[model samples]
Target: MNVDSPVFLFDQGIPGFENLRQFIFLEIEGNIPMRLMKSLEDQHISLLVVSPFFIYPEYEWELSEPVKQELLIKTEADVEVWSIVTLPAEPSQATLNLLAPLVLNRNEKVGKQLILHDSTYSSRAPLIRA
Candidate 1:
């Protein structure tokens, strides 16, 4: 994941964050599996993200044809999936938004937050099993 100079350009931006189109992915220090997705347009708009597979080993999804074409994703290796993390006052109550995921094309440095409209997944799935 050599994303040193990578700038994720979201053509339509993430939902609720339409004003932000450019972002930088930065790994959170001391947290190997966590990352800081900071919007270049607004420093305050930073999202805590993590590879969903890290918490949910069975996490998987197919990118829609339109998404594949828009992101220019040709191979599976070109894509990296991440989920937004919600940290509650009680860390044990933290959750991950599984219904919507952030998919990035490592090859093209573009990304999007795709909402799974017909999926069984939940928006506030537990981040870890009890």
Candidate 2:
């Protein structure tokens, strides 16, 4: 991770967490693929996030033109995707919200949680393989 990683601005903020608009992605110590998305506005509002592709190799989606324009994404290389993970009381039950992925434009440092209108992905897809 870059020491000067830009703070991502979610203009409308994440759904259900509308109050949080700015966040920085922090790599969790000892967790290679997990990251802590810490909200700048609310210190306590941190989320565990990961690139869904790490667990689901086939994970893929086409960003709508509106989304691309909103994030100022000029090319495919400018996009980075991640999913919020829910850590259950039982660690093994941890799941990733694949239905609504966090799409960020690395170039603009802006992001949005895109909820698919219709998809096969689940909001609670298991983190680990069965």
Candidate 3:
């Protein structure tokens, strides 16, 4: 792990990979707006994520009180949201998982993948910037 990198703790880890806890957000070296969420415990566990608001300008979701308290989130500014990207053989065919967004508390350096039960958005939404 890079000493300079800020480690984000996921108390419950990701949905399927619940055992892995610690993660670090790495910026991709290029013009692409994507970020690499690398797991500290597993070298093979890295996810490509991007800000959902960049793709869907009007994208919005409500965080439950439990989630806010879990991450120690106090205000809207303390939160950051990211969507996992699924890239197919063709880059243009990539999709973003909007149904379950990764919500992070910037101040606390903790995060959780939140599943929106009442969301009309799809799990595989077209990755087109609006």
Candidates 1 and 2 compared: the better one by TM-score is 2
Per-model TM-score on C-alpha atoms:
0.93, 0.94, 0.93
lDDT of 1 by residue, 41-116 (tens): 8878989998899888988777899999999999999999999999999999999999999999998999999999
Model 2 TM-score?
A: 0.94
- Model 2: how large is the Cα RMSD against the reference? 1.8
CA-lDDT, candidates in order: 0.89, 0.91, 0.91
**Per-residue lDDT value at 123 in model 2:** 97
Clashing pairs in 2: none
Which residue runs does candidate 3 get wrong by more than 4 Å? Answer: none
**Model 2: per-residue Cα lDDT over 63-117, one tens digit each:** 8999999999999999989999999899999999999999988889999999987
Clashing residue pairs in candidate 3, if any?
Answer: none
